[model samples]
Target: MTHLVMDVDTGIDDSLALLYLLGDSRAQLEAIVCTAGNVPARQVADNTLGWLALAGAGAIEVALGAEVPLSQPLQTTEDTHGPLGVGYAELPPHGRTISGRHAASVWSEAARSHPGEVTGLVTGPLTNLALAVQLDPELPQLLGRLVVMGGALNHPGNTRPTVEWNTAVDPDAAKIVFDRFAGLPAERRPILCPLDLTERIVMTSAHVERLAAASGCAAPERILPSDDRGRRSSADVELIRQLSDAIRFYMEFHRDMGQGFIAHMHDPFAAAVALDPGRAQYRPATLDVELAGRLTRGQIVADWPGPSGAGIWGRPPNADVAADTDPEAFFDALIERIAAVALDGPAR
Candidate 1:
C-alpha cells in the first residue's frame, strides 16, 4: 500500500485529485491538510470534508492549514473555481469536524508516524509544507517521496507571463521546498508537474462523457460549450452530475482563456503521478524561485545542464521535473478508477 498525506486548496482540480486518491486502491490516504488557495483555508476544509462525505471516507482526518502564505497575503481564484472553490458543484455539507491541529503540525506528525513509508502530495500552494519544513529541516528527507503541482518551465505561465498559480501564490514556500530538498537521493526528490506537461493533460466533454458512461450513468452527461455558463448537471449519478457541472465551469474558463473548450487536469494529473510514477517521465534539474524579478517574482528557474554536460550554476539537481507523459493513458486509468469509486455512492 502507498501511504499518503495530501495538502490541497480544494479547487475544482484539487477536488478531482482527492477523488482520484480516494478511488485508487493503492493509496492509503492518512490525512488531508487543507490550505488556502483557490479559496480560503476554512472554505477549503469545508470543501474537503464535503468531498470525503461524498466518497464515504468521512473518517479521514481533515486538518486546517495556514490561512496565508509565508510572506504574502493569501490569494484565491474564485473566478476560476467558482465562489465556493469547487466550481459549479455545491457538495452537500458533510457536517464532519475538521482536525483541531494546524496543518504544519499535522504534516510533521504524519511524517513522524509513517516516517519512510508516507509520500507527500501537495496540489495547491506550498505554504503548509514550507512551514513544516522550516520547523523541521529534516522533514523533506523523512518522506518516501514528494510530488508538487506547481511551476512553469519551458512553457507559458498560467498565472502570468512567467509564473504558475500555485507558485505565484507562495513563491517563498516554493523556494524553500526546492532549496531544502536538494542533495537528497534522486529517488526521494520531489517530482514537479509543471505546466508544460500538465497543460497537455486536457479534459474535453468527450472525456467527461466517457467517465459518465463508465460510471453507469443512464442519462447523457455530455456538456457542450454552447451550454449556459451556470448550467447544473442532471446526470443519474450524483458524483457524475457534480463532476460534469464542476468540470464544465473549468472547461469554459479554459476556452475563455483561448485554450479551447478543455480543462487542464493539473492537480489530478499530479495525483496520478504520485500513485504511479510510470504515468510520466521526469528529468532531474536544479530548481529555484525568482523572488526578486520585477515581472517574474514567482517564476520557477530550472537549470538544465549546459551543452558541456555541466551545471551552469554548479549546483546539484534538486528536482525531477516532468519531461513527458501520455495524456490518453492517464485519462483512461482515471475514468476507470474514478468510475469505481463514484459508483460506491455517498455516505449515509
Candidate 2:
C-alpha cells in the first residue's frame, strides 16, 4: 500500500476527502496534518480527530500546523462550514491523542521515516508545506510526489474571479512550495489539481444523499451535517442527521448564488487524482501561481499555448497539470472506494 500524508483544513469537503483517504483500501495513511483555512488550525486538528474517530480510524496521528497564512490574514467561509469549522457535524469528542508536534515536524519525520515512498495529499492552503520546506530543505528529496488541491488553471474561481480560495489564502506559502518543488530533481513528481478542472466535478444533492446513506452503513456519525437547521426531523434514530440538512442548506446557498444545486467538489478531485491518476485527463505542462497581479493574484497560470506566450507567472513549472476528468466515472469510482473501505472497516 502507498503511504499518504494528508493535510487538510477540515471543511465539509475536507471531511469528505478524509473519508476517501481513511476508507480507500489502496492508501495507507501515515498521518494527518491540519492547517488554517475555512477554520483555525487548532480547530482543524480537533475536527480531523473527530472525523477519524467517526471513521473508526482514530489510530492515525493528527498534527496542528500554521494558523495564519504567511503574507495575509486568515480567511474563512464560516457561513459555508459553520462557526465551528466542520458545518457543525456534531462529531463526538476525540478519544485519541492529538500530536503536540507541529505540522512541519510531523511532515519531516514522516518523510524521513518513509523515505522516497511517501506521497503528500495537500488539500488545504500550502502554509504547512512551506514551513516543512523551511525546516528541512531535504524534504523535497524524500517525497515521492505532492498532490496539491488549489489554483485556477482553466476555470474561474469561487472566492474571486481571478483567485482560488486555497491559493488566495496564502500565495506566499504556495509560492514557496511551488518554487521549491519546481527545483527538485526529476525523482520528485508534483501534481496539481487546479480549480480549473476541479470546478468541473460537481457534487449534487443526489450525490450527497448517496454518500450520506453509504457512510451511514458503517458509521452513524460519519455524515452528520455541520448545522442543526439542516438536520432530519426524525429524532427516534440515534444517527445524527445534520449533514443531510447542511447539504440541503449548502445546495440552497449554491442555488441562491446562481451556482445551481450542483457545486464542484473541489478538494475531493485532488484526493481522487492522488489515489488514481489514470482516471482523469492529464496533460504535461508547466504550472505557475501568479503572486503579483492585483486581480489575478493566486491564480494558476498553466503553460498551455496562449497568444501571449506563457500567460503570467513566467517561470516554467514542473508537474503534470490536470486538464480534464471523466466526471461520471470519477464519482462512481469515489463512491465505490468509499463503500468498499467503510464496509471493510479500518486497516488491520
Candidate 3:
C-alpha cells in the first residue's frame, strides 16, 4: 500500500481528492494536515473532519496548520467553494477531534514514525510543508515523494494573469519548498502537477452524471440541481451525495469562467499521481519561484535545456514536472476508485 500524508485546504477539489484517496484500496492515509488556502485554517480543519466522517475515515488523524501565509494575510475563496467550503453538503460534526499538535509537528511525527515509507501529497498552500521542512530539515529525505498541486508552469495562472492561488497566497513558502526540493538529489525531488497538466483532467457534467449513476444513486436529473442550491436531500450513499453537492459550486464557477460546466481535477490529479506516478507524463525541469516582480510574483519559472543539451543559464534540473496526462485513463481510474468506495463503503 502507498502510505500518504495529505495536506489540504478542504475545498471542493480537495474534498474530492480526500474521497479518492479514501476509496483507493492501495492508499493508506496516515494523516491529513489542514492548511489555509481555499478557506480559513479553522474552517479547513472543520471541513477536513467533516469529509473524514463522510468518508468513514475518522481513524485518520487530522491536524491544523498555519492560519495565514508566512508573509501575508489570509485570503480565502469562499466564492468558489461556498460559505462552508463544501457547497450545499451539510455533513454532521465529527466526534473525533484534531490532533493537538500543529501541522508541522504532525508532519514531523508522521515522517519519523513512517521513515522512508511516507509520501506527502500537498494540495494547498505550501506553508505547512515549508514550516515542517524548517522544523525538520531532513523531512525532504524522509518522505518517499512529495506531490504538489500548485503552480502554472507553461500554462497561464488560474488566480491571476501569472499566479496560481495556492502559490500566490504564499510565494515565500513556495520558494522555500522549491529551493529545498531542488537541493535534493534528482530521484528525491518533488513531483509537480501544475495547471498545464491538471487542466487536461477536466470533469464535465457528463462525467459527474456517470459517477452519480455508477454510485447507484438517483439519476442525474434527480440529484443535480440547476442552481447553486444543489439537491436538498441526500442520496443512497453518503459519499455520492457529498461529492455531488460539493462539485455544484465548483462547476458553476467553471461555467462562469466560460470553461463550460466542468471543473479541473487539480488536487485529485495530484493525489492520483502521488498514488501512481505513471498515470501522467513528466519532464525534468529546474523550477524557481518569482517572488520579486509585482506582476510575476508567485509565477513558477521552469528552465528547460536548450537544443544543445545544456542547462538553461547553467541551472540543473530539479523537479519532475508533469507534461501531460491520458485523460481517458485518468477518468477511468477515478471512476473505478469512487465506484469501489460506493460499493464497499468508506475505507477503514
Candidate 4:
C-alpha cells in the first residue's frame, strides 16, 4: 500500500477524489490537509473533515493548511463549484474536528516521522506545499514524490485560454514547488497533470450513469433536473455516487449549463495517477511555470520538440508532463474501487 498525504482545496471533485482514495483498501491514505485556493483554507479544511465524515473516514488525520499563498493573492471559482463548494446541497456542517496543527506543521511532522517513504498528492493551490518545503528544508529529501494537478502545458485552459485554476490561484507557489523539485536527483520525480493534458479527459455521461446505477438508491426522476442545462455535459455519467449534496448541486449547475453530464473532472485526475502511474501515459520534459508572462501567466512551459514536451524527470529537460491518460482504463479502475467502499447507510 502506498502511503499518501494529500493537500486539497475541498472542491466537489476534491471530495470525490478523497472518497475514491480512502475507499480503496489498497491505498493507505495517511493524512489530508486543506489549502487556500478555490476556497479559503479554513473553509476547505472544514469541508475536508465534513466529507471524510460523510464517507465514514473520520479516523483520517486532517489539518488546516495556509490561508493564503506565500506571495500571491487568493482566487476562487465560486461560480463553478458554488459558494458552499458542496453546491448548497444540504450536508451536515458538523464533522470530526481536526487538530490545531496547521498544514505545514502536519507536513513537517509527517516527513520527519516517515522519512523518504511518503508521497504527496497536491490537488489544490501550491501554497501549503511551498510553505511546508520552507518550514522543513529536508522535506524534499524525505519525500517519495509529488504529483500536482495544475498548470496549462500544451492544452488550453478551462478558466482562461492560458491559465488553469490551481496555478492561477498561486503561480508563485507552483513555480517554487516545480523549481525545487526540478533540482532533485533521479530518485525523486514530480508528476504533473497540467490543464492541457487533463482537458482531454472528462467525466462522461456514461461514467456518471454508472455511479448513479451503482448508488443502490432510487434513481431520481432525472438526476439532471429539467431546468438545469449546465449539468448536461457529455461527461455526466462519471459522478461518484456517494458524494455530498454540494457535489450534486455542482452537478445540477452543470446540467443547467448544458454541460452537466460532461463536467470535466480535473483535480481528481491527480489522485488517480498517484494511485498508479501505469494508468496514464506521460512524456518527460522541462516544465516551468511562467509567472511573469502577461498573456500566458501560470502557463506550463514544456520544452519538447513534439506537440507535447519530451524530457526526463531529473535530466536537463526534466519532469514528466502527463501527455495522455487511458480514459477507459481509468474509469474502469475508478468504478471498481468505488464499489469497494462500504458506506454505513446515509450521511447524517
Give the number of the best model, judged by lDDT.
1
lDDT of each candidate versus the true structure: 0.89, 0.74, 0.84, 0.70
Any residue pairs clashing in model 1, and if so which? none
lDDT of 2 by residue, 156-181 (tens): 78788967888889889988887788
By summed lDDT, the worst window of 10 consecutive residues in model 1 runs over 339-348
Query: Mind giving the per-residue lDDT tens digits that candidate 1 earns over 26-47?
Result: 8888899988899999999999
Give one digit per residue, the lDDT tens place, for model 3 in 226-276. Answer: 654454545677777777777777877787788877788899899999999
Best by TM-score: 1
Cα RMSD to the true fold for all candidates: 1.7, 3.8, 1.9, 4.5
Q: Give per-residue lDDT, candidate 3, residue 59.
A: 74
TM-score list, all predictions: 0.97, 0.87, 0.95, 0.86
Error of 1 at 321 (Å): 0.6
The regions of model 1 sitting more than 4 angstroms off are 307-309, 345-348
Candidate 2 Cα errors over 4 Å, as ranges: 184-187, 212-246, 305-316, 341-344
- Those runs of model 3 whose alpha carbons end farther than 4 Å from true positions after fitting are 218-234
RMSD of 3: 1.9
Q: After the best TM-score superposition of candidate 4, give how far the Cα of residue 115 lies from its true spot, in angstroms.
A: 2.0
Model 1 vs truth, CA RMSD: 1.7
User: lDDT of model 3 at residue 40?
Assistant: 94
